[model samples]
Target chain A: MNIPSKLIEDAVTEISRLPGIGKKTALRLALHLLKQNEVHTEALTLALTRMRQEVQYCKKCHNISDGEICQICASMRRDKTVICVVEDIRDVLAIENTNQYQGTYHVLGGVISPIQGIGPEELTIESLLERVSLSQEDEEEPIQEIILALSATMEGDTTSFYLAKRLKEKGIKVSTIARGIPVGGELEYTDEVTLGRSIMTRINYSTE
Target chain B: MNIPSKLIEDAVTEISRLPGIGKKTALRLALHLLKQNEVHTEALTLALTRMRQEVQYCKKCHNISDGEICQICASMRRDKTVICVVEDIRDVLAIENTNQYQGTYHVLGGVISPIQGIGPEELTIESLLERVSLSQEDEEEPIQEIILALSATMEGDTTSFYLAKRLKEKGIKVSTIARGIPVGGELEYTDEVTLGRSIMTRINYSTE
Candidate 1:
């Protein structure tokens, strides 16, 4: 009844459930799918099924993993005593792509958002504290540092503040990732890279 | 090391194989599918698998069907003596949606395109002629009409001309679906209601 076949229209309906796809674009996608062979469709289905089935969160640090522990968590070559906490798995991947952080990661799943009913209970913060404290029981040396790798959004700042207060009570060194202009989110709209350097130079958080 | 997760990147690669989907939009689609629960993913996979596995073209008309005979071919109410030849299965469904004709269809798979290397042998032209001849053998009334429902493109016009010549040799009255403007493609963005009226007033094609 629509611009294309019933099969095409049905495919469009399924695709339209995505976050930003509209009906017209959905139709375009569906028509495209129809033209492809079974191999292509099978590959897509397999990827989706694998993403759901293979990927899970690390129990110790909460980073995304194909196993119980993520690559970073299992790697003895990295600095296990330094943990970088982030708001989501996406942030972890973004940080990992930079190949700079030798420390492991903790993914909070989401920021604390009162409107969306997300709170401390909904996050992996408790597990993080437990992991940091696990150092005392195992003779692996106390967690020397914690890096707050949350976004620079309002919620991210609030979450970092909450995390900082809690970690300070337990007597661990804590620091936040700098609030400099993001690699892509903007910089001369922020020559703020220079301004950020000034802030880092003037930093006065406890170094322990 | 790409802009998105590896699993997401893999899914996008698969989805981009569809007819018109590009890499950017496919990435968005893959991300959307990942965000959904197991049930949504499972449903989509099932639909995709069924589309490839369960669907087959009808022996009689070439329209997509779950059985040897398409739904239209199996329907007793349809007039067997009038066969509307269409460019593809999509066109058959589009006409069926109109509910204007009681006749069955014969899908040509595609129009004659020398540029694309599609010729009469590549189509269902032989099968169509055999079907007409078989009707005569079965003591059924001779096939009275053959309608060419194709797009108003150059290839469509050429195909219609060739098909009309073939059917007229067999003594069947052949016609084309009216073309003043498309129902949706644009007559300054046509309404289907106006398009329907124009179909009723269509002029006949002359060999002259």
Candidate 2:
């Protein structure tokens, strides 16, 4: 893009490395930082650096934390026996925002993607198993259910299948989130696969 | 959106400060950085900080530069007597990319916008006038023309009009880029204001 300065070009190159940001957008962002006060730029850089260097992974769930354990893992109000497994930290935040699930979360860090050269070993699958086994050994409020709340993708399914097999041997219940058309989705626009799955797994209409 | 970690939330807040980025996208980006190798995040932060702190503005034209003078302003091949004035650095980059304009540039930093509390004093207008006067005093390659290449907005027009009035006294030609339907733009979909202006400023057609 014929950047005028080496500094701006260097900044743009690094910013464009991020997911979803293109070269043009990177240039815009870099120019924005240039226009802003130096303190603002320093603050942004400091925050990102601290987050990268200081942010810890919950040994039990692998969720991002400021300390040894995540807030959710340390909270007494949450259902420690029920763990919702997710592929990414963003997924954990998404579920937390819904406020429907009161259980703890186990961030898989990533799903099993063979095409991306990612295997089960590369993820936090072993930590999850260790968490469950540790709880069982303690015999105090042992993990009763593990909810596979991963995405509706091939990688998600493969990871869930693999985890379910292992968790079943440990005598713990392993289940998956339901797949259906979204609540506000129209029947006409619904994809055939989702519609078919909804029909096959339809629940009986009984008011409690 | 119920971020899991204070460090993550801080990073997300800073990242979301960028234009066009929202809270959700910020969280996603933060999580992405967390998953990536630490070196990548450090590189991004270092580049941005260095760019913000080290980038210099050309004293002659106010364009971003690594040294005292920008590459365009310092190059002897560029027509220094003919200057194209623009509102921002991105505009300078845009004109440079066009490969049509051989003249040097004068970056006004921003257009006059009363609503935003930005006036002539807030821009590089005084410096531009000073530059023209300095060249006139030298009596060598006096500026023959000053092109107002600002955006076709009310503020851009106001700034151009203000500059034109003062520049006319110096006996130098003042011109603005033509405002009309964009290249390949459909006449049917063109707005009335632009169509009317185009018709009023229409020139004789001839193969030059």
Candidate 3:
């Protein structure tokens, strides 16, 4: 694309550097910005720059936060004894939206993926272990359960297995979220591996 | 949807204001930027801000440019006697990519769309007429042809019809690009209107 203006070309180049946006989409976005009010463009630029400059990671859970500790970790009502481990902040947001879980979260930042050269040490695993150990010092209510709520991928499974092995030595109960056919899913459409797991882990149904 | 950090939330809100970007995609983009190097985010913000602030419009052709006059209008190699009138800069770029058209262009900025509350007065149509009338004053090489190269949409058709009526009174040759089944398009799947037009405007074939 022979873009006429140097400014437009530079903007399009920068925008196309994003993950899923291509040159065409970037051009469209640049044009759209051109058509919008100048204040809108200023707000977008300011928000992005401020977010990058001022954003902080929670010291306790390693999730994104504006301060030292995240809101979820600082909240007294949340069940700190049962920490739900997630791969990233997006999962925390997803689970938080459900509003079913009352426990806090430990964002791993990412799962263990040897292909990406990311290992257990690169993540927040060490800090999580430290948190668990510190909880043991509190004799009143020690850490009881650690829920592994990572994705259902190979990297997720490997990280779960590694964490479970480490947590078991500290006498902490380790559990994983159940995997099966999703609610309202048809049996015939479910994949074979999930269907087999669902059948093997089938629980006794009751109308109570 | 429950973003933990205020910075992330703000960034998502601004990013989602862009055309075709939803809240989920905005969140993903914000997180992606968070994961990237700080310099990348800075560069993106700077590029967007500078582009919006410093960009200028061409005086002669109404196309986007870094200077007063666009490159095509300022170049001596381009034919000044023929002007291809387009709806926007994107169409100018598209035509330039073909490398076939040697004439300059007049970018109308947009078509006449009553539904969108856009009229001829809102576009650069008056400036185009002024250019043609000025060319008549030159006396040596006046604008010989005006190509109505707008899109095939109803708005484009209305604008083209209006321009052709106005330009014909000035005794300048007016033409439009032909529409037919696209090259490599299957005849059976082509729409009725286009297929009928293609047959009505069929040209003679010769072995020479």
Candidate 3 error regions (>4 Å): A204-208, B204-208
For candidate 2, lDDT tens digit of each residue in B110-158? 9999999999999999898998899898877888899999889999999
Q: Pick the candidate with the highest lDDT.
A: 3
In candidate 3, position A78 carries an lDDT of 89
The C-alpha TM-scores of every prediction are 0.65, 0.97, 0.94
lDDT (tens digit, per residue) of candidate 1 on B1-208: 3532456556667767765678766765665565557778787777666665555678988776667887788898999889999987667767878879899999888889999999999989899988887886776656778888887788998999998898788887888876666544766577675577678876668832
Q: Candidate 3 residues A1-208, lDDT tens each?
A: 9999999999999999998999999999998898788999999999999999999999999999999999998998988889999998999988998889999889998999999999999999999999999999998767899999988899999999999999999999999998899999999999999999999977777832
The per-prediction i-RMS, to one decimal, reads 3.8, 0.9, 0.7
**What's the ranking of the predictions by DockQ, best on top?**
2, 3, 1
Q: Could you give candidate 2's per-residue lDDT for residues A79-119 as a string of tens digits?
A: 99999999888888789888899999998878899999999
Which ten residues in a row are the worst by lDDT in model 3 chain A?
A199-208
- Where does candidate 1 chain A have its weakest 10-residue lDDT segment? A1-10
Query: Which numbered prediction scores highest in TM-score against the true structure?
Result: 2
How displaced is residue A190 in candidate 3, in Å? 2.3
lDDT of each: 0.75, 0.91, 0.93
Error of 3 at B86 (Å): 1.3
Q: How many backbone clashes does candidate 3 have?
A: 0
